[model samples]
Every structure is written in structure tokens, then in C-alpha cells.
Target: MIRASGISLRRGVKVLLDQSEFTIHPGERVGLVGKNGAGKTTLFALLQGELDLDAGHLSMPESWRIASVEQHIADRDRPAREFVIDGDRDLRRLQDQRAATHDDDGQRIAELEAALLEADAWTAPSRAEQLLAGLGFKPEEWLLPVGHFSGGWQMRLALARALMAPSDLLLLDEPTNHLDLDAMLWLERWLVSYPGTVLLISHDTEFLDAVAKAILHIDHHKLVRYKGGYHDFIMQRAERMQQAQIAYQRQTREAARLQSFIDRFKAQATKAKQAQSRVKALSRMQLLAPLKEDSSISIQLPSPTYVPDPLLTLDKADLGYGSTAILKNVQLMVRGGGRIGILGMNGAGKSTLIKTLAGQQAPLSGEKVAAKGLEIGYFAQHQLDMIDPDSSPLQHLARLAPDVREQELRNYLGSFGFSGDMASNPTAPFSGGEKARLALALIVWQKPNLLLLDEPTNHLDVDTREALATALAGYEGSVLLVSHDRHLLRSTVDEFWIVADGQVQEFDGDLEDYRDWLLSRNASARADARKETRALQQDDSNSVDRRTQRRQEAETRQRLAQLRKPLDKQLGKIESQMEKTGERLQELDLLMQDPNFYTDQYKDERPQLLAEHGELSKQHTELEEQWLDLQEQIETLAQSDH
Candidate 1:
């Protein structure tokens, strides 16, 4: 167990943790959460012994091994797998000793070999490869030089290295920031199964919920611990705050009564003793600190002046860079008020699709039609780099709307948490979260009819992420979101588009279903690989004739296709019904949102409308279940064919 008693930490004059004490038991996965500048990293540094506590006793097991991802890695021509394997210092030390041994030292060599076997040195390469694979590196890339990969890929490599190391405790900071949905899912499974304590800091609520057994939140320079995952912590914290508020209110009433009595009767001879006693009592009373709500930032996207239905259309388009088509024969339509989430593994052309739609890249073939007065608010990581570092948020907004008043621009920036000096200061010193907010502010200022966001929540903290979700939810425009933040995806997108196998298509399921599909697909691939290896080792003479084998395979495929045709037809019918039911639900939702819908004028029609809505909703759910069942069956048949 790790314990901190009366720990007080500071950076210069700013106090981060003052007399804060918290204990984390062995094997507990704890999530550390706070605002962007709330000293979470400082706490991690203190735990790592990189910083000294100004006042406190911090203790942990002296023999425990700790592992964390390195923020910087030397650029070198080292094989990625080798780099990861190097994380195991013990194994490396054993290998080094063996290499330095003389050939005549047979006894020492035997002892070293036994020690190597004890340490499982022989399997280190495979273990390293597994970590690399889990972090989204392809098998072929395992042997590539670490320097050959881009910075983001290098970060993934660093994460793999950390995971490869044997340790009693692991510290992960935003581990999923550089990961895709598939990689994030893989990492979650790995972390959950890890037999070690983990202290993680992440803005991803879903990730926290999946991996954390407890939450350690920084509230007002104090460490507060809550049991269970992030969601449970949220509920528990809210209840605690509510109870605190009630206590505070009761205390206030009592204090006021005592003060009132003392004021009214202190001058009277008859009640002088009582008044003095009350004053003494009041002076001795301990005052509870008032609950101060943290100022939450919010954004308001200006409504577009005009919204055209079917805002953009891609017809048999080939989306990619230069001559290579990452997404072939893509057919998609973005209509006004449509909210879409893009889902895919890393390197699966999700960004390419978004870029193509945003007009950052033209299609190699086929037509991309845009409706008149079309405006797109495109945001990607690269957009942050486009911001003028020397200019203030006000200046950036002013450039977009030169005719708008300076006060109005300042007010607009304030909504994004850029108030006073922040709005006027140059953006060079701003943190990633601030820069992301500014980029979004610039995008919102345009009042675009369509929002094309690619990982907009990457650098955003939990509160800012919630604010963005809220703004996107209420915005009167179409949205195409590409993000790994499941919470944001669930809140902002109504439908999903999956980019996979060089094609983009509608996914008829939610994020959970996508996860299941990915798992099944990976399993099938492994099985196929095993089968291929077995076939390769068989004698040629024992194998069936090539023509006969081909004929049998063709027959099997034909039978499977014949069996699937009816099911496919039925699935199509169900999908059409679901679409109609979904449209009706949307219509009902719009009607219910109207304030006048509950008025006396429409009182008689309300019941009928609600009843219809309930029936449609039930029907939609049934259709969805059926759709998922059929999809699973189709996928099974497809896997069998493979």
C-alpha cells in the first residue's frame, strides 16, 4: 500500500496540495481526475520521487517496482520490438552478463542460462510483440526502426514499452490520447487483467469507468477518494455535495438566529447575561466552509443563417491522397441536422473520409456535390497548428468576423473560457486544452451549417468535453464526428459510419456492437492464420487435387450465399422499417421540444401523439434487436466462408 500523511505540495507560491492525505491499497486501479491545471501531474511527480513534499510523510513499499511511459524517447535506429523488450531491465541485465562471460567459464555459463530460463528471457521477444500489437502496431512494423515511425506512433511505442515492463505498480497519463477506438479497447482489456496497482490520469470518462476501481479527485487542494468507477464516483460526489449544502444551510440559519438574538438583546439589562453567553457560543462555533461551485465553461455555436437539406453528397467517390484510394467507391450523404459518428481502427481511412467530406482533399473519381450556401466548420488536430501563435483569441475571432465589434468578439471568446487577460494574451503560452478551445471558437464563429470534427476532445478536459457535447447536441447543424471518446460519441452522434476494408458503410449498431465485431474479426483472423500454417506443413501428396479442392470451396461458398440471400433480404426489410420508425421518433422529439405543444390548443392531440411515439419507439427497439441478430448471423456465415 502507498500512504500519504499530511502531504503539502507547492510550485513556487501556488499551493497544489495542502495537508492532503490519501491512501491507495495494493492492486487498486485508481483514476486521478481534476481540471487541466489542477496539479494531477505534480502529484504523479511526487509519487515518482521527482518532487519533494513540502510537508508530509509519503511511504510505499521499498521493494515495489514502478513503471510509467517515458515522455521522451531517443530517436535511434532500433527495432521497435527490441526497444520495448529493453524495458525489462532485469532480463537485459541477465543477457548482458551472459554476453560478457568467457567461453572457458562453463560453470558460470550454465548458472546464467538457468537464471535466464527462470526469468523467462526466451519469451521476451514474443511478449514485446504482443504489447506492440495491442498498441496498434502491425506485425510487419515490429522490426522497423523506432525512428521511422511518426511522433504519435512513437508515443504508442512508448506505451507498449511501459506495458512490457514487469512492475508492481503502473502510472498511466492519458494513455488513450494517441490511440484509436480499437487500440483503446485493447488497452482497457490489458489493464483490467494486469495484476498490479494502476494510477491513471485521463479525460476519457468511459476509459476511467472501464479500468478504474476507485476515483481520486482533486477538489479545492484536497484529495478526495470515492469507491467504484468514474460514474459511481460522480453519483457519490453529487450526493456528498448535496449533503454538504444542506449542512451549510442549517449552520447558516443557526448562526443568523444567534447573531440576531445577540443584536436585539445585548443592550437590555434583563438579557445581558444570555446575550453575552450567546456571543461567546457564537465565537466558539466552527464555521463550515461554503461550497463553491467551480466555474464551468460553455460554448454556444451561432445558428447558421441557412441550412439546406442534403448538405453534401458523395457519389461513388474514391477518397485518399494523390493516387492511392484509401476509401474506394464511397457513397455518403450529409443532410441538415444529421449527427454522425465515424468508427474504425487506426489507419482505416476515417480521417480520409472526413477530409474528403470537408473538401480538404478532392475525390479521385466520382462527384461530390455540395448544396448552395454550404458552410463547413472543419476541426482536426492540424487545425490547432493553423492558429496564429502571436495573436490573441480576440484577434483570431476578429479575423473571421472583421466587421463585428471588438466587445462582441471579446464576449464570444469569453463563452469559451477565454476571459479578460486570456482573451487578449498571445496563444503561444496556452495549453493544449486552451488551444483546442480557441480552434473550436474560431470554427463556431463561422456559424457553419455542417461540423466536421476529428478528435475534437483529444486535448479537452472532462468538463470542457461535456460542454462541447452539450453545444454539439444543441447546435442546429449537421455533424460528422471522428473520435475515440465514447461519451462524446454517445452524446453527440445519432448514427454511425464505419470505415473499413477500403470502404465506408453505415454501422447498424452502437459502440458495444462495434467492439464485439472487432473481437470476433480478430479471432477469425487468428484462426485463419493457424489454418494456413497447418496447411503449409502438410505433405503435398496427402493433399487433395487442386481442381477438386477449388471446386469444393466454390460449392461451399455457393451454398452459404444461397442460405444468406433470404436472410439478407429480410434484414433489408427490417432496416427500412427501422429507418421509418426512427424518422417518426425524430419528428415526435421535435414536436415535444416545442413549448406550445403542451398548451390548451394542442391538449387533445398530445395523448395521441405520445401514444404513437411510444408505439414507434417500441417498434424501433424490436427492429434494432432483430437487425443486430441478423447482422451477427451474417457475420458468422461470412467467417465460416473465410
Candidate 2:
């Protein structure tokens, strides 16, 4: 366990955190949430002892071990397994020395054996593999050189190494940044079941909601604590704020009336004491200024004109890298009026399939025939690679679309949230999301018939997500695209194509259907895992069996316990959440009341909070039901006691 008491962090004169207090207990998963550049990373650094505090103290068990979800990996050429083992050099050295001795050095052997036992070295490799797989890595990927993977995959590998490490505290900064949805879900499961304390910084709402039991908010150089998940935190924060608001209003009105009376009768000897008393009350009253919560998703999107008719088609398409077929013979078509989504795992050939049709890559021994007179514009996920670092956004737009007027170009970029001083700045300075949007602007400026897009919404905000969804919905050409955002895919794409097992197949449905199928698949996998674990346990209590079977059963039981608690507790948590959500709605109502709606407050924040609550309610209900079923199962298993 670790605790930071009255901590204040400062950089020269600027304070990052002021008088912050937080307790991180063993097995507590905490999420640090705030806007970009709001000290989330800085907090992690402070916790890791990489950043010094200006005041107060941070304390933890002296023997506590710490590991970071390393953002930068130094071992590029090393095997992934080597990286995992080498996480703690002392442990690795002890294991190696212990293995080499064959009764050659009795005392040294004894010492090494003691060290291995203390380090739990016997189970380390297996645990590493398990963690790696949980983080969406295949067994073979463990042997691949870290340098060979993309930046995203490399980050995941680093994170995998850290998760595999035996540590008392895990400090993760933006751990969800490079992960696809599958990997994110995998990480979430591990975090929830993990016995160690976790300090996770992530922008993914679903990840935080699922894994974090407590939320630590860093804002305005101050830290605040809420005793539940992200949704609960927001709701609790809202309710408290609303209560404070009502109290303040009532007090302020009384003070104002008293002041009026004093002002009217201050000169009269009979009323002077009453007037002064009212003024004193006003001075002592504490004002509760509202906190703005919706700054993260505010984005300006431009509406585009739609063109008519089907823009392109793919006939008997085969896409792959070199002679190795990533996708077998595939047939696909996109009509002008409908939105389409391409879905798959990290290496599922979704991008490659689109690339082959767009002429970015050649198919393996198969023809990709596009419709006649089709003008195809392609935006690859690696569009940033195509950008000339030296060119400005304006320069790039001008070079790509020479006929467009400067004002038109500026307007286009502005629509995508690159406006004013930001528009003329060098494209090299833009963030990943900015670069992605700029590339999109370039692709759409050409007015091509068929659009081939790969990972189009990788780093976009929710507002931009909705905006782009609307734009794609109206685009005249057919959209052959791949994106990870379920919300965007739900509105923009009409059908889904799943590329797996060296083939591409069309699945006619939306994201909702995909989610339902995945949940059922997960339930089946969970059942199978539990069954296998039990069989292995009954076979033996070897380290592997104990870890795999006994540990799993224990974890399932723990989850069951949390779910089976009294209904009063469940309803209390929900009602607490409801009060705060009601306050958030009230705040949004105020924002909606404004015709301009351009203030610093969260205009759309309330709606998102409400939707998040619906999800939380569902999860709570499901968990409760699962608990009841598991209880019955446990009782049945113990029937021999009778």
C-alpha cells in the first residue's frame, strides 16, 4: 500500500498538484482522470519517484516493489521473452545461477534457491506468458524482436512486460493509448482480477469504468477523491456540487435581503447592528463555484456536401503481404448511399484488404477489379507517414489540391478543429489526431468517387467522431473503411466484414450485433476456462495447476462475493449515483438553455454521463444475477455435507 499525504508538486513557480491526499491500498485499482496536460502523467511520474514534490510526503511499504507500464522500450532487437524475464535483473540472475549449479556449490545453491523461492521464479515465465496473452499478444509474438512491431504494438509489448512483472504497485500512464478494443478489454479483465494495487491513467472511459473501483481527479492544481468507478465519481461530484449550489443560493438570497435592509436603515440607530450582522454573514459565507466537466469532447465539425451514386466495387479481391496470403479470395462491394464498417483484430488483414482494393498494395494471385470510371481516394492508417514534415498544413493542402483557394483550404482545416494560428503552423508540430484529421481533409478535397479509409477514427475526440460520422453518412461515394470506435461505426457503417483465419467474410449487421455476439463468446470462453482450470486442479497441485485452477476459482468466488452482497448496498450505490446524475442533467439543462452554448462548461457532458449510468446499471444487474447463479452452484457443490 502507498499513501501520499498533503502532497504538493511544483515546477519552478507553477504547481501541478497542491495539498493532494490519496490512499492506494493493496488490490485497489485507481484511475487518474483529467484533460490532456492536466498532470495525469506528472502524477504517475511523482508516484514513481521520477518527479520530486515541492511539499508534503509520499509513503509506501519499504519493501514494496513498483513497475511502470513503460512507454519507451530500449530492447528493440531482444526477444520478447528475454524482455519479460529481464524485467527484474536480480530475479533473472538468481534463476540462472540456481539452474547452472548441480551440487557444485552447496551454500550458493541454497542461497539461490532461497532467492528463487522468495521471487516466485518458478512461476515467472508462465505468468509472463499469461499476462502477455491477456494483453492481446499471441504466444509466438513473445519470440518476435520488439523492433519489428509498430509503435503501437511496441507500447503494448512494453506494457506486457510490466504486467508480467511481480510488483506490489503498477503505475500505468495512458495504458490504453495504443491498444485496440480487444486488447483493451483483455487488459481490463486482468486489472479487475489483479490482487495488486493499480494506478492507471487512461482516456478510455470504458476501461476506467470496468477496472477502477475509485477515481482520483486531478484538476486546477488540486486532487479530489471519489469512492467508486468513473461514472460514480462524476455522479457524486455532481450531486455534491448541486447541494452546495442550492445551499449557496439560499444563503446568498438571505444575505442579499439582509444587506438591502441594512443599506436602507444603516443610518438609523435602531437598525445599525442588524445591517452590520447581515454584511458579516455575507463575508463568512463560502461560495461553491461549479466545476466544468465536458471540456474533453468539445469539437467543431464541418458539414460536407454529398455526391450521388455508387463510387466503387471490389470484385474477387485477394489482399495480402508479398506471397504470404493474409486474406484469401474475397469479394466485396459498396453502394453510394450506405455506410460500411470493416472490423477485425490487430493483424486480421482488414487494413490490407482495403489497401488492395485502393491500389495501395497488390493482391496475391488475384485480381482487384474496381468499378468503371471510379476515382478512388485512399487514407491509410499510416497517413502520417505520407506527410512531409517540413510542410505546413496550408502548404500540404495547397500542394495536394492546387485549384482550391487559400480561404477554402483554411475553412476546411478549421472545420476539422485546426483553426486560426494552428492552421498555418507547420504540420510537423501537429499531434497524431491533428495529423490524421489533416490527412482526411486532403483525401476528401479531391472529391473522389470511392473512398478507401483504414482506421479513420484512431485519435479523434467524441465530437469529431460524431461529426465525421455525420459526414460519412452523407458522402456520395461508397465508404470502404476500418475503424475501432463502436459509436462511430454504429452510425457510419451499414455492414461489417470480419477478416480472420486467413480469409475475409461479410457479416451483415451493426456494432450492437457485434457486441452481443462478443459477450456470448466471452461467456462461453469464461465457462470453458473455468472448466479447464478445475480439471487441471483435480489432476495435480503443481505450480501450474495451482496458479491456473486454484487461483481462477478463488478469483471467480471473490467476484461472486462482490456481486452477491445485500440489495440495500447495491441500491444505495445506485441511488448515490442517481443523485449526482440528476445534478449533471440540471447542469446540462442550464447549458442547453443558452442559445450560444459556447461556454467552458460541459454542454454535452450530461448526456454522456446519463448514457454511462445506463451501462453501469446493466453491469450491476448482470453481476448481481451472476452472483446468485454462482451461489447456487457453490451450494450444489457442497451438498455432500448433508
Candidate 3:
């Protein structure tokens, strides 16, 4: 359906892509995989004619219409139907003009008729409604103003528009970025059954593996096409790289032997001919490129000073917003060293309940408490907001943690990729990946007994994201996580807590199984919702019950506003501590350099100095334990509410 031959995409001197050759057959489902800046989005733009490639021929059927899902959506005040139909901007504009004026002139009338027929203006509303409904938007929500929705819902509208149009090929860029678990599964099914060709770029590994029949790897300014699933592609790349390494090694050995032969035999004419011929052959041989082996990302989480035995407990817990509660009369006992996954849709009250579990917020009209040793490390989804860009990591840490030594602090920063000069750089200029890494490293450094991570992998590169996941999996403490990254959830978590429309569903299984169950339950949930909506509409009152509706809506919106800040502030303490410790560690390094400094200190201070150091260590550990306990408790609460 689409083909890019010798395609080279560049901006000024920076080459985004170079001579990439690939072909997409009609009705093919292809996963475009690459690193963060490997031009997956840029390639899609070139094919859609949104961006021009530097060189090469891009050929596809002239009649084929292409659709793309843009990342950002602005001006969401219009209704869902109107926003989707607006994709055909010219048609919508002409219709607006026609509605405002009584221009019976032949030129305008004929033009309007032609445009209306081509754009399917009369049926656009029906199509838009159906597409939105299939994407989980309700019939009642069809008329709701888009301005009321959050970023996640706005993304859904963009995707709905993209899917609404009849296109021969679809190019989706991070289409599942803000999607919850259920919505992601629905999209996977749609892609699997879609009639047109699909090219999807996403960070979701499981989603890619589930839907992609072929993998198109964009790497090192070239295209590495593999004709199979994502797993097949991984193995293929590994094998290809291995073979190249072997060939390169063999060639290098031959080159060395030939050079040695030339050095020893140049004086003998007969032997010289052989040596010279070998040199020419070496010149003709193209040097095998250096092997680009995939680098593994590893992190060493700081150990706990004092672990909590019982993380959290809830007896008859009624968690929700206001009196119209969500999960009611529930009992849950969460022990320490727990690893839990909170799964649900956008308005599931997962956050509200989780906060209650953390003891940072209270459950509505219910009894909830935590163990004494509970130290929580709550990492909110938007945790980076607490970090100040103006200060250096060192300065930030010094202000937050007074007891940390300078040399120890630098060592912590070094482990997280901020070695030497990088640690001294202003944090304001840090990329999203760097900031995310700093957040995770900082929190883990404090050695919290329980950790609550909310959407930690959103803007991270695949390598860094997986590293974070790996570290979390290896953590000895308890954990509660709210994330859309299925790979991370599946690999790291053993239990699933699903939060849906004002109810929580707990299941004992891996993420893969949970996904299967969710897909099955989704159809049933839709049917029940539709039936309920119809019954409510029959009443002389509004479409949905006002009290029930307000409670449900407020859980997501109002609670999001209240808790986003405090949780982020709590988690930022780790980075704050790390920065201080780094500075202290550096200071100690300087002092230790002077051989007489330790001897001089010992002369004045003996037991008191040693006692103070012990006290600092004891304080740091106690704080970490409390932070961890709180984090786990909150996470457990999130699961229960879900």
C-alpha cells in the first residue's frame, strides 16, 4: 500500500533517517519500533505528507487516503460529533457558510452539493457517533462539551476522528499514550481485525506484540524489516548482529595477518606479490561496521533500614468522593513487601482510594488505618512537577537532606547516569527521560519500605523504562503501582486490582491473564451501561442520575486536583536527599584527599563525631521506612477502591 525507497529524512545537518527502504503491503499490520529519537514519528509524517523527507521516493496508491492521530489536541469546546466531522475542515467550513447565508447562486449551490456528496456531510454525524461509541464514549457523552474532558479523553477524540474517516492506510503515533488498560485492549482488537493497512508507533511492548504481524525497526538511520511478530524480530536482529560481529572479527584478523606478511616479505619479490595482492583485496573489502550491541540498563535500589511488617489494612472501607461512596464495606489486609498493580479506566477513582491507603487522604465514611512502621514513598504520576529546574542536583539535595555526606551523594548520582559534570548541570535543562530517572533513583535511594509509583514510564525511553521496571521487580519492599505499561505490569506485578465505574475488582493472576479477562468483561460492561442509560433516560429527569453521576465524575476530576501536588512533593524528597548526599559525598572526597584531615578531626572529636554519624544513618533509614509504608498503604487502598 505504501513504499519508501532510498528515503532520507534530514533537518539541516541532522539526519533523521538515511536511505531507508521498506514496503507496506495492503491490509498489513506493522509495528514500527525504535529508540526515543529514532525517527518513527518523522517517517510517519513523511508518508502522510505532513513533513517532507530530505531525499528518496515515497510511492503509494494515489487513491489511498491516510489518517494520523496527533499527540496534542487544542480547542476541545466543541461536541464530540462536531470535532470528528471537523477533520474534513473544508466541508465543515462550507456547511457553516451555507447555514449562515441563503445564497441560491448556482456557483455556491453547485459547489456545496458536490462537497456535501464527497464529504458524506449528511451521514457524518451518525458515523462520528458510532465511532465514538465504539471507542467507549457514551451516547449521552456525544453531546457533552469536549472542554469538560481531561487530556486522556481529548486524545481519545483525536483517535476517534482518525478512525472515523475511511482510509486505505492508518498511521498512528503513540495512539495509546493516554489510554487505560481496557481501552488499550480494545484498540488491540480493532487493529487485529482492521481491514486497512496499519503502521503504529508506541512504547507499549505487549500491545505491539499482540497486534503487529510484522516489525519495522528504524535504527541507526536505516530500516531493518523483519517478516514476523515482535518476538521474531527481536531474535532476528540478535542473530543478524551476531553474524556481523563474527564477519567483522574474521576480516580484522585477515587484515592483521596481511600487514604482518607485508612487513616481513617486502624484500622478496615473489612473496611481495602475494603480500601486495592481499593489500589490494583488503582495500576492496568494505570494513564491517562496528557492532551496535544493545545496552542493558541496570539500577541498584538502596536497601531498607527498617522494613515494615504489616503495610496496610482496611476494615469495611468505603472509599470514594463525598457521601456517594465507591468501594463500600470492604476489608483488605496488605502485608509488607507487597507488589500490586492498580488497573482501570480514567474515571475509576483509583487515585482517590490509593491516597486514602497512603494515609495522606481519608476514605469516605469508612474506617481506614495503617501500621506504625509504615513509611510511604508515593510517586505521583506527575511527580516531576515538584522538581525545581534552577537549582543543581547538589543544591536541591543539600537543602532537603542535612545529614547526607557529599561523597556518598555523588556516588548515588553516578549510578543514575549523572556522573561528574552531568551532576553539576542545571536540572531545568534536563530532558523528560533524565528527570524521570532522577525521580525514581532519588525515591529508591531513601530505602522506603513501600513504594507507590504512578505512571512512571510515561515519557521514558524503552531502555530506561525497562530498567526502571527491572529495578522495581527486584525491590524487596512492598509496592503499589498505577500504570498503563502492560509489559512492566505483567513482568513486575503478581496481582491485579481493576478499578472501573465506581467499583473495584481484584484478581490473582499475571497481567496477560488479567488483560484477557478485561477484554471479555468490557463487552458486558458496555451492555450494562447502555441498559442503565436507557432506563435513566426514560425518567422525566436527566439522562443519568444526578447524585450517582456527580460522585463518579468528581472522583476523577476533583480528586486529581487535590492529590497531584502533595504526592509529587513527597516523592521529590528522594531526589532532594540524593542531591544533598551527592554534595556531601563530594565534600568528604575533598576532605579525605588531605591525609591529615581525618587525623585532625580525631584529635578534637572522638565518640561524639562517631555518634552523630550513626544518628544520621538511623534517621535516614527511619524516614525511608515510614515513607515506604505510606506508599504501599496508599497503593493497596487504590486497588481496593478499584
Give the winner by TM-score: 1
Candidate 1 has a TM-score of 0.82
RMSD of 1: 25.7
lDDT tens digits, residue span 578-626, model 1: 9999998999999999999999978999999999999999999999998
Ten-residue stretch with the least lDDT total in model 3: 559-568
Q: Each model's C-alpha lDDT?
A: 0.91, 0.71, 0.75
Name the candidate, 2 or 3, with the larger TM-score value. Answer: 3
The numbered model that scores best in lDDT is: 1
lDDT of 2 by residue, 585-637 (tens): 56655656776655546566656755765665566566556556445544533
Spell out the clash pairs found in candidate 1: none
How high a TM-score does candidate 2 get?
0.70
Q: Give TM per candidate.
A: 0.82, 0.70, 0.75
Candidate 1 positional error at 195, Å: 0.9
Which residue runs does candidate 1 get wrong by more than 4 Å?
A: 264-276, 533-642
User: How many residue pairs clash in each candidate at the backbone level?
Assistant: 0, 1, 35
Native-referenced Cα lDDT, model 3: 0.75
